[model samples]
Target: MAKKADKYFKEDKWKIIEEGFNPDYGMVSESIFSLANEYMGVRGYFEEGYSGNKLIGSYFNGIYERSEPDYNHYKGVADFTEYMVNSVDWLYTRIEIDNEQLDLYKSDFEKFYRELDMKTGILTREFVWKTAKGKRIAIKFERCLSMTEVERSTWQASIKALNFNGKIYVTTGLDFSNIHRNSGENMWNCGEKFIQADKNITLGIEGTTINTGLKVSSNCKIQADYESMEEIIEDKLVAVKLCINLEKNKEQKITKIIRNLTLKDESQKEEYEDKKAKIKDGRDDVIVLNEELKEESRKWWENVWKRSDITIDNDIENQQGIRFCIFQMYQTYNGAVKGTNIGAKGLTGEAYNGNAFWDTETYCLPFYLFNDREGAKNLLYFRYKTLDEARKRAEVLDCEGAFYPIATISGKECCNLWQHASLQLQASTAVAYGIWFYEKMYNDKAFIKNYGLEMLIEISRMLATRGDFDKDGKYGYYCVMGPDEFQMMVHNNCYTNYMGRFTLKYTIEKVKEMKEKYPKEYEKVVKKINFKESEMNKWKQIIKNMIIPYSDDTLIFEQHDGFFKLPHVDIDSIPISDFPLYNHWSYDRIYRNDMIKQPDVLMFMLLFNSDFTKEQLKANYEFYEPRCIHESSLSPSVHSILANQLGKEEEAYDFFGFATRMDLDNYNRNTNEGIHTTSIAAAWMNIVYGFGGLRSDGEILSLSPTIPKNWDGYSFKLTYNDEILEVKVNKEEVTIKTLGNKLIEIKVFDKVELINDEGYTYKFT
Candidate 1:
């Protein structure tokens, strides 16, 4: 059966709270409370240890290990795959009172409470332990990844003896024995360890076997009011044991400040050598103290709230949901580091092998574009850096130019399934869209000329060569899959063809503009790529002849050629146990039916909403909404946005919660795998694009806001055209006010209005 939201968490405007611990929902809670700061993420597993179901995930972005591939004679199949490997357990802790180690699964506990503070980026958990000898001890654990520092994490534990005076022992340090859950393999080889007992500090370094040049160094400093301390070093483990004398009703706090630095042999050799020399020379390992790190992260989160917070007045459930979404979005990625993109699970879990998909551009980019433009540029820049790998992938598939991978960790195609790895075209087109979209929002023409235009030209080349004309002389992609995974190897998938046309047309337009406005720089880029006039002519020709399936009578586009001829299955009739059909049903059985894994035609409609009329959107929404099973985490929010656009308010709200609480409620029964990072972005899209009526596809920023029935009002912020605008929607009217000093032009219900410091208001009819 599909999992329902466990609802174990208490609702609050700025926190996710759990009053009593439920072992049945342990993994789900771990995922919901996971903490990350772009640089690293750690699942909310027990620091004192849990014997029950749990994934001890602590991941660093861009650090990955490659696995041997199953050899296949097929040409387009991937020969090997690389995945993000599980790294150091920075929160590893062991608490011992009278030699009885604290284990939540085995120990007696009361008043178990945990909360993830959205406003401050801290996760706190506390419980009272009843020892075997009838002594009670209260313990609290708090952790936060520094938002400002990026590479540092602070873990603090407070303990008090409630009944009797006793000695409590705490062992904590960075542990490097983590295993990749999917492969059941420990990929790291412990390299070096240093301990300084007098200073209460330890450092360790480990390197992956396959990707040996990738090394991670963890330096930890222990601070506590303890009676004694000792350094303990073991195989693949480095820790310090602290003995603290506790008096009745007196609390003692121990803090572990950790800083992790990752280095690649290819890019960071000098920096790595310098750090190694410093460690060897016995220099102090620098780290931000706990309170200082906490303060810095507090200011960082405050700024994030000032710029990105969405306020929902009447519904605390959704209010908490949306904040949680925004908080996770920031935690997953803040663009602090270059050469990194949002993973499918965003360092939350091991699922998707810690690889990024097309969702980085298609779904996650808008969130960052509106909140952090620099970060958005980094996302696109990662693609540009990986362009050579993309070109190699296209050559492997017997095509020209760049073909961005379906999944990647270090910019190489890693998905093993040939069907998805080779046939899907959205990944390439999504990169082009990201470039176009980024330029549209920020008006950074230099970024396009310097970095984006080259990628766009190569992507246009890939799409042009990858597709061909049918016997009827109509250009379309054959044997391909669109956004909907359920229908594969189909010809003329409307979404794919339309996006291809968009990519080609956009690339052509940019090339012409560059030639006219910046002829000198344009000539340099053109010469670098060996520019040919014929290729541009061919792209224009393909754009003109691209076939997008549509029906004039119904005003509804067929999802793909022969899609209507496929036998239909009643999605509602499917048993709950059969959900996530990939697991329960035969693989071939899924593709034979008309059930959609996600939006295909509706996806393009949303991406290019400005190009379609209301009647066309309504017609397609009515026709396609029923067939979607929404197996993908990115599905529901797209439906929600379109439903709101069509005035189906009730249906829109129905799908809204699913995107916001997909992990919190554990609706898909897969939260154990990881947080749905893309769906988290979609939740933001639901509020801003769905209910707030914001559309960026057109020239002028537009809005046609509608308040949900349960909401008293809602407000959100958007960063556009180098200005921040606060948009508020209530029952009576919609308000748009610039947070900056500049006047902004926006379309409200098809009427143009100028908004400034005083704001512009449009009353509902």
Candidate 2:
């Protein structure tokens, strides 16, 4: 087996390499090599059977099941409701030779190789297998979830006889018997099952949920000369088997096209018609389907890369890491489905119960805002679609306006923890921030005129009602959880207060703008929400008097009220085994100890960097950084961007590397459960926001490009104000080029430069 470091980079920049097979790491590899196309995803498992620890997960977005919650003293929580559940298990196949099954554990394997090609979105594996009787056969397999057609998955296997060839049988079908579960028990609890078999296909299975009444179906079309058979192994376990014959020293190939469909939002007739059309639409030959779809998939990826690709000339590892992140981000969510937000685990796994988090708005939206404007708008549109639910959530909390969920599937709060779900008011603010962020990025006022303004107003109303007079007799928020979950139930959280204040002030400004420009719309909103002038005055009052805790002696903002008074403990004092305190410590112990889970004040500084001085940024970063454990996957990328701006190059690289390879390295030891979907976007942020040094202040765009202390250079393209600009930085100089024809002025490290209509190359030495 090759060392883990070797997998970071190879000569092929587009491929992720897995050197040798180990049963222990099989599930981890499944996550890192998972393939998805926004609608459906398939885990990267071997076509031939493997008796090992594996989670064979195939998921469809927005399709879910109902499960009863074990409420622990929480009021207003639902008794029995539907949430996102693991849909089905689709990756099932077995190869047999002379009735001797070819399993990984049972057979001797040599010369094994596995890789996931990011550019092509294909996973390939090849190995040589030898049976106990000295019979040898070489097998190669290729798999992909079609990017062009989001509902279909294609799998192909090629086998050749080396020593002896009597009969080679490949049994490929869908098995719902074994699926992924966090605990020992099954989560799906799949109900009624039905199968249909005919000449055009081998087998098809359709099932309905017990409580949700949601129907899921999996059908396989096999293109091979094989005998078809079906068996009901156990009480309800069913599988379809196909047996084939092979000549000596002759090569045989088979392709299995699997189509998965769900009746989540569609009627039964529409579903059947759509399935029938898809069944007859593609070619009968699997090789032709593979080539044709591969070409279309290549073109689709090319269009995105041309506008958003980045190149790190000095480091191949970082280059691969950045592309991997971008590829996965696009694969996970492409803004096709409205009112559907991304889960923390994406379609890759069932961890977090397939619930979305605030990470989508806070960490993931910026990537889409710059590269895919439509995608960014869809994310906000989802929030708008769920506004009523947010409002209901706020009412449940005895507050006004909307209170966004910490983790949710259909916009209802799914998190059971009180501190995380209810008290994290910043989530609602983050949704509002995303609206303002998208408008700022594109300078599009239509968004505000259409949907953004209403969202802001409701969120601001919630913030105003949630705040009260603190110990100092000043208006501020209390008993809130900030970005750092380590410090729970604290008063006057700096990030929450500042963001709340900003939300109030900004919404009031927009309200006035609407009243002046679009009076009818403004009046309609006011009438709908029953807004009174007195409430606006109260918002302004709170915004003016909101207190942000800061220490004058240290020239840095305190994370929250009385944060300095906690029992201060250095992270190094903890043992290595107790590294992640969440698993080892009780909530009471974790709350009082002065250990930071992630940046709190530093995150505030990064968002509103211009609000603070460089000295203050440095002081706050230095004070809070050593205490941080970076347990959350979202932590390192924020620190990386800050370190780059603060001229801490070494620290910047360390944090950047940690985030870019988070899943590949299995740093948190949770990749087996799922990949960190939201953190994947952070990799792009570390480049565009860190090394590229791109920042926007209203209508003015600025860059302060800095090269890491490595080798040659790095460059990336971004869309700003509907114009594309490519920023490249090297050891000695920085250069900016305009890809679109436009006259503009931008600041390069605080110096204004003019870019003419023909485009300009501004070089700073």
TM-score of each: 0.98, 0.92
Question: How close to the true structure is residue 137 of candidate 2, measured as C-alpha lDDT?
Answer: 86
Overall lDDT per candidate, in order of appearance? 0.88, 0.76
Q: Determine which window of 10 residues in candidate 1 has minimal summed lDDT.
A: 204-213
Q: How close is candidate 1 to the true structure, as a TM-score?
A: 0.98
Tens-place lDDT per residue, model 2, 1-765, is: 011232432334678987768777888888888888878776776656677777767777877765666755566443444455555556577888766888786689898888888777878888888877788888888887777566677778888878775777676666655543753344444443434455544445665555666666666666666565544333223455656666667778777777776776554658555664544544333333556766777788888788888888867777777788888898888876656778788888878878888879888998888888888898888898888989998898888988888877777777767778877887898988888788778767777877778888889888989889666658888888999999888998999999998888889888988889988888888888887767888898898789889888998788898998888887776776775667788758878877888878888788777778889989998888888877777888888898899999998987887566777777677788888988888888888888788776434777888888784988898877777777777777776777878766888787788764454454545
Candidate 1, residues 1-765: lDDT per residue as tens digits? Answer: 134676778889999999999899898888988999998999999988889888999889988888765556478777888888898898889999888999999999899999988888989999999989898999999999998778788999999999899899998887888778988988888878877655555555555454544788887777788888777787778888889999999999988878788885466878866766665455645554788888888889999999999999989888888899999999999889987988999989999999999989999999999999889999999999899999999999888889999999888999979889999999999999999999998889889888888999889889988999888778999899889999889999999999999999999899999999999889988899897867988888788899989999999999999988889888888998787688999999999988899999999999989999999999999989999998888888899999999999999988886777778787887888889998899999999999988899998889989999888999999998788999998899888999889988889898898889799988887
Backbone clashes for every candidate come to: 1, 0
